[model samples]
Target: MPTVDPTVLERPVKLHHLTFLDEGEEMTVGRPDIDAYVHLPRDGAELLKRLADGDTPEQAAAWYAEAYGETVDMSDFLETLEELEFLADDDTEVTTAEPVRWQRLGAALFSRWGLAAVTLIVVAAGIVLTQRPDLIPHYSHAFYTPSLIVVMLTLFLGQFPFLFLHEGAHALAGRKLGLKSRLRVSRRFYFIVFETSMDGLVSVPRGKRYVPILAGVISDLTATALLIIVAASTGGLIAGVSMALALGTAMRILWQCYFFLRTDLYYLTVTVLGCKNLHATSRDLLLRRLRRLFGRPVGEPISATETDRRAARWYSWLLLLGYAVMIFSLGYVVVPSLVFVVGEVVDRIIEQAPLPLLLDSVVVAVLIVGQFVVAGLLGLRERRLNRTVSSQPKAGSR
Candidate 1:
C-alpha cells in the first residue's frame, strides 16, 4: 500500500451518478459516469459515502474504527478506489452534452407508446403465425422459385439495411434516456455484427436500462413479425422475399442467446445483479475449472471482490451452459450448413454455363471465403487481447 499523509486530507470525489444497491446480504456502489462500480461491505460503503460527502480519509477511517471496533486500512482502501477510478482528480472532466446527432429522433421512436405499439404488433404476429401455420417460414419457401444461390444473395443483400436499423434501435432507446450512442461494426467470431455503444445507459436507473439493452432485439423481432405477416398475406415473389426476411430476422433475434459473447441479455443480467465484472469473473471461473480438469495449476475460482463472487457463483453456470450450447450449435447447425452450402456452390458451378458459372461461383466464393478470413482475423485479435490482459495485474491484488 502506498503511504498517505495523515495530515493532508484527501479531496472528496464527485461522480456523474451514484447509486447504492442492496442485495439482501450485500451492498453495492454504482458509478454510472465511468460505467464502473464496486461492491463493498456495509462499513466500507459507509466510509465511502463519507469520503464522497467530503470527509477526509483520516476522518472516515476514525469514524469507521469507532463503529466497527477495528481500524480501517485507509492506504489500501484509497488505492483500490483510485484503481477503480472512483476517486476523480482535478484532471477528470465530465462530458455533459449528448454526443449523438439523432438524439431527438431516437427518443421519439422508443418512447412508451412506441414500445407499446411494438408489443401489440408482436402479439398480433404471434396470433397470425399460430392460426396459419403454413405462413411460418421455411428454407424451402425461399428457394421455391428463384435459384437457391440467387435467393440467398438477395436475402443477404436485403439484411444490410435492416442491420443498420437493428443497431439504430439501441441508439434510439439510449437517446430516450438522454444518453448518446454510436454505431460500430464488430465481429463475434466469424459473424459481422452491427452494434450500438450506449455506455451512458449506465447512468440511468437499472429499471430504465432494460429499454436500451433490449431495443435491438425488439427491433429484430418486430421486423420478423412484420415480414412473416406480409409473407402470409401476400403471394408470389413478394411472399418469398418476405418469408426470407422473416427467417433472417428471427435467427438474428435468437442469436442474442449467445451470452458468452456479452450479448444484450448479458448486459441486462449484469445491471440487474449489480455486478461490476461478471464476464471476467465468470471467465476466470471457467479457466480455473479447465486448469483443474487438465491437471494444471488452479487458483481461486471466486473473485477477490465479494459482490463479484456472489454474482459469479450463479452466473458462472450460465457461462458454462452458453459454451456448451455454442459447441452443440457448431456441430449440429454450423458445420452441416457450411458443408451443404459448399456442396451447393460446387454443384451450381458445375451445372451452369461457362459465363454464368464464373459469375455465380465468384459470388458464392466471396461469401464463404470472406467469412473464413474474418474468422481468422478475429482469432488473431483475440489472441493479442488475451496476451495483453494476461500481462496486466488482476484487480484487488497488492
Candidate 2:
C-alpha cells in the first residue's frame, strides 16, 4: 500500500492496482480524492482513466457501456463520484464555531412560549377555515398549480435549512448535556447531510441521547408552525399558495418519521437497542440476497451498522407497498396533473384517455412500490448502534 498526497487535485494523478481479474494488464484507476489515477484491464482501465481525466459522468457511463458492450447506468458512476466529492466545489461546508440563529431563538422560545405559539397557529388556521369556508376551496381551485409548484420547491430548496435546524437541535441538546457540539456535512447515498459529530455526543452519558436525537424534529415543528402562521396572514393568490406550500412542506418534514432512513427517530430507537453497527449487518443481509440472485459466491458475514437501518428496512418494505398503492394514487393524483403539463403533445397522437397516462401511472406506481420494498428491507438491517448503552433503559434516553 502507498500513502497518497492529501492535496492532489487540479491535475490528473495515476496509480496502478491489481485488476479485479487475475490475468490482467496494468489496470489504471484515478482517485479524485487523492487525485491519483491508475490503469488496469487495459481497455477497461483506459476508458476509466479517460473518465477520471475529467470526462463528465455521462461520458464515463457511455464509455463503460460502449467498451464493455453492457448497459451501464450513469447514475451509479455519477452518484459515486459526487458522493466522493469528485465534482467541482465538492467540499461541503461544516459549521460548529458560531451558533445557528434559530437554535438560540428556538431555545428561548421553546423554553418560554413554544406551546403558546403552536396553539395560536392551530387556533388561527381553524378559525380561518371555519369563518371563510369558501376561501380554501377557492384558493385550491384557482392557483392550484402555482401552489403545488411552491410546495414542491419548498420540498427541494428547504432541505438545507431544515437539515440545519436538525443539527441545531443536536447542538442544543448537547449544550443541555454539557457537551461541546459541532455540525459537519457527510455524504450519504450520494447526498450531503448534516450531522452532529458524535465524538462528544457519544462520550456523554447515554441518558442524554434523546436530546440530540429529538433536536431536529423540534426545530422542524417550530419552523413549520411559524411559517404556516406567517403564510396564513398574507391574503391573495400568493398568500393562499404560501399557506398551502407551508403546510405541504411541513408534511414533507414530518414524512421523515414514516421511514427509518437514518432519521432522528431511527437513531432514538437505536439508542434503545444498544447494538452497535446494526446497519452494516443488515446491509450484509441485503447483499447476501443480491448475491443469491446473481449466483455469486457469498462474501462477508453480517455485522452491525445499527438498529436504525433495520427499522428503516421495515420502512423500505412499506415504501415498496406504497408503490403498489401509488399505482392507484398515480392514476388518481400525480398522473392527472402531469397530463395537464404535457396534454397538448400527447393529445395529438393518442386517444381520449391516452395510453401514455395509464402507462406512466403504472411506471410511477411500480417505482413507488419499489421504494417501499427498499425501505422495508433497509429497515430490517438493525445497526444495533445504541445497544452498547444496554445498561440504560431500552425505552430510549428518556
Candidate 3:
C-alpha cells in the first residue's frame, strides 16, 4: 500500500462537500459530488479533519498521542484514505455546475407544507373510508359491472401515470437534496418497474436518505388515500373510476414488500444498515448457502470485502423472508385474483357478451406479450453492449 509522506500531508487536498454526520452510534464522512461515503469512529473522523485542515502527520500524531495517550498509525491511516480515493493533490481540479431546474420543482412539491397537506388528506380519507366502508376497494371491485372488460382496460391504462408519479417522487426527493437523478423504466422478469437513479443519495446523511428511499411508497399511499376520498364523495362513473385507481395504487404499495427485487423498501433497509453492497453480495451468499444445503457440487464462491461480508451475513435472512412472502403472495393473492378474473371473462363470453370478451382477452394477451417483448429487447441490448465491449482490442495490443 502506498502511503502519504508526512511532509506532503501539510498541504491541503481539494475535496468536494466533505461533511461529517453524527449518526448517534457512529459518524459518516461524505462527499456529495462523488457520492462516496464511509462510516468512521469519532477519533478516525477527527484524524481526517485534522489532515484536511492542513495538519502534517507529525502534528496530528502528536495531538492524538496527547489526547488519547496512544500512538496513532498515521501511515496506515493515510494509506487507507488513499486507497479509498479520498485524497487529491493541489493540482486536482473541482468543478461545479448550476443545479438542475427540477430541484426547485421538487422543493415545491415535497415541501414541509406539501407533506403536511398530504397527511391531512390521508387522515380525512381514512375517516371517510371508515364511515362509508363500502367505498373501500376489494379485488372484485376491479369489475365495474356491466363490463369487467372496460374496468380492466381502464386500470391497465391508468396505472402508467401513477407509476410515473411514483418514480417522480424518488427523483424529487433526490433533487430536493441537490442531487442529480434520472428516471427510467426497467424490469425484473416480466414485471415492469419504474426506477429513479439517485446514486448521490449515498453521499447525504443517512437520516436524510430515508426520505428519498421511502418517497415512492409515500406517493403510492397518498395517491391511494386521495382516490378513496374521491370515491366516497362521488358516485356513478367517477366513483367507479376512483375505486379502480384506488385498487391499483393499493396493489402498488403492497408490491413494495418484494424487497428482493430492490424495491424502495430494500433501498431504505440498505441505507439504514449503512450497507455498501448488500444486494449483490447477500444474493451470492444466499446462492452459496442454497447450493450447500442441496448437496450441489458448487465451485468456490468469490470472496467479498470484509465490510460487504458483514452486511451480507445479516441481509441474507431478509432475502429469504422476501422469497417466502413472494411465494405466499403468488399462491394466495395473485393466483386467486387471476383465476377469478379469467373465470369472469370466460363467463361473460358464454353469456353472449362476445365482443367485450374478445376485447378483454386481447388486452390481457397484449399486456402478457408486451412484457415478454420488452424483456427480450432489453436482453438483446445488453448482449449487444457486451459484444461491443468484448470486441474492443486490448490497450497494449497492436
Candidate 4:
C-alpha cells in the first residue's frame, strides 16, 4: 500500500470531482465518484473550496484563520478527506460513465408529456372514484376468493409486481438525474420492504430531490387509481383481482404516513427540514432521556447540527408515539388475526375437514409463520454484521 507523505499538507492537494450545495446554514460537499458527502459549516466549505482550487494546506489554514478568527487543523481535515476518499493522487480529471440501463426509460417517464399523461390518468381515476364510490378500496377487497389459501396466495404473490413498480419509480427518478440506485430488501420494523438506495441524491440540489423522494408514493397512488378504474370497467374475477390490487396499493400509499419508521415521507421531512440525520438523532435523544429516567448512564450528548437538535426535541415524542402505534397495531390487528386464524385451523383439524380444506389451512399457517421467520432471520443477520464491522479496526486507527 502507498503511504501518505507526512508533509503532504505543505504541498498542493489533488481532489476528485466534488459537488457543493448550500443547505440552509450548512453546506453539503461530496465526491460523487464515491458517493461520499459531509455537512459542513459555511467556513469549512469555503476552506475546502480553497484547497480544491490549488491552495496549499498552509495557505488555506492562513485564510481560514484570517476570515474565521480561528485556525484550522490541516492534518485533521486531511484525515477526514482521506476517509471520504476525496484525495486524488494525480491531477487528471476523472469522469464516470452514466448508468445506461434505465436512463432513457427514466427520462421518458419524467418528461413533460409523460407527466401530463399521468395527470390525466389520475384525474380520470379521481372522477371515476367520485362517480362510483363503490369502487374505492376497502380491506374487504383483499378477500377476493372464498378459499383462505387463495386469498392469501393472491395477496402475498400479487403485491410483488406493484411493490416493484413503486420502488422502481424511485430508482428511475434518481436515474433520470444520472444518479445510480440499487433496490434491496430491507426491514422496517416487522415489515419486509423493498428499498431503493440512492446515496447520490445527497449531492444533488435540494429542490430537485423531492420528485425522487416522492416517486414511490406517487407510483402507489397511480397504481391504485389505475386498479380502481380497471375494477370499475371489468366484471367477475378480473374485477376482484383489480380491487385486491387497488387495496394493496392503497395500503402501501398509506404506509408512507408512518414517518417514524423512516419511510419515504421521513426522508422528505428531513430533506425539507434541512436535517442531516433527524431520525437517528431523535432516537438517540429519546434513548438518553429514558436512560436518565431509569437512573442509568446517559452517555455523551448527541453530536448533530443545531437544526437537527431542535427538530429532535419534538421528533423524539413522535418517535415514542410511533412505538405506541406499533404496539397498538400488533394488539388490535396482528394478535387478533393470528388468534382467529389459529382457531379456524384448530377447528378444521378437529372436525376432520376435507383434504383441500385442511391443506388450505395448513398452507395459510405456513405462509404467515414463514414471513415472521424470514424477518427474524434477517434481523439476526443484520445484528451479526453490525458486530463484525464494529470489531474491525477503522481506517488510520493506531
Compared with the true structure, what per-residue lDDT tens digits does model 1 show for residues 49-115? Answer: 8887778787888889899999888887877776776666657664334255677887778877888
The residue ranges of model 1 lying beyond 4 angstroms of the native Cα positions read: 3-33, 91-107, 180-182, 198-205, 266-281, 304-325, 328-353, 385-398
Q: Candidate 2, residues 1-398: lDDT per residue as tens digits?
A: 22323233224323222122221333323332232222234655455556546665456557777878887544444333343333443344321233334455445544536546656765675566676554342324324454433444444454566677667767776665444556765433322356676444444345667656666776666655555555556666555555554554465466556333465665676567753444445555666766888999987654333344555466445544544564776578655755554554355336655676555544544443444455444444323433555644332110
Q: In each prediction, how many residue pairs overlap at the backbone (N, C-alpha, C within less than 3 A)?
A: 0, 70, 0, 0
Colliding residue pairs in candidate 4: none
Candidate achieving higher lDDT, 3 or 4: 4
RMSD of 4: 3.1
- For lDDT, candidate 2 versus 4, the one ahead is 4
Over 129-187, each residue of candidate 3 has an lDDT whose tens digit, in order, gives 88998877788668766775577677889899899989889888888889877777777
| Candidate 3, superposed: residue stretches over 4 Å from native | 1-19, 22-27, 38-51, 54-92, 97-100, 270-281, 291-315, 324-360, 376-398
Predictions ranked by TM-score, top down?
4, 1, 3, 2
Model 4: per-residue Cα lDDT at residue 16: 82
Model 4 alpha-carbon miss at residue 311, Å: 1.6
Model 2 ranges with Cα > 4 A deviation: 1-163, 180-199, 231-234, 258-260, 292-295, 299-398
On TM-score, the candidate that comes out on top is 4
Which is the leading candidate under lDDT? Answer: 4
- Taken over the whole model, the C-alpha lDDT of each candidate is 0.75, 0.50, 0.75, 0.85
Tens-digit per-residue lDDT, 1-398, candidate 4: 33556678689888888889887678988876666777888988999999989999889999999998998777888877777778876756654434546888888998787778888889999999899988888889888888767788888898999999999999998888988788888777778888888888988888889989988887888888888888889889999989988888888888889999899999999989988889889999999999999999989866688889999999999999999999899899877877887888899999999989888888887788777667778888889988998897554221
* Cα shift from native, residue 291, model 4 (Å): 1.5
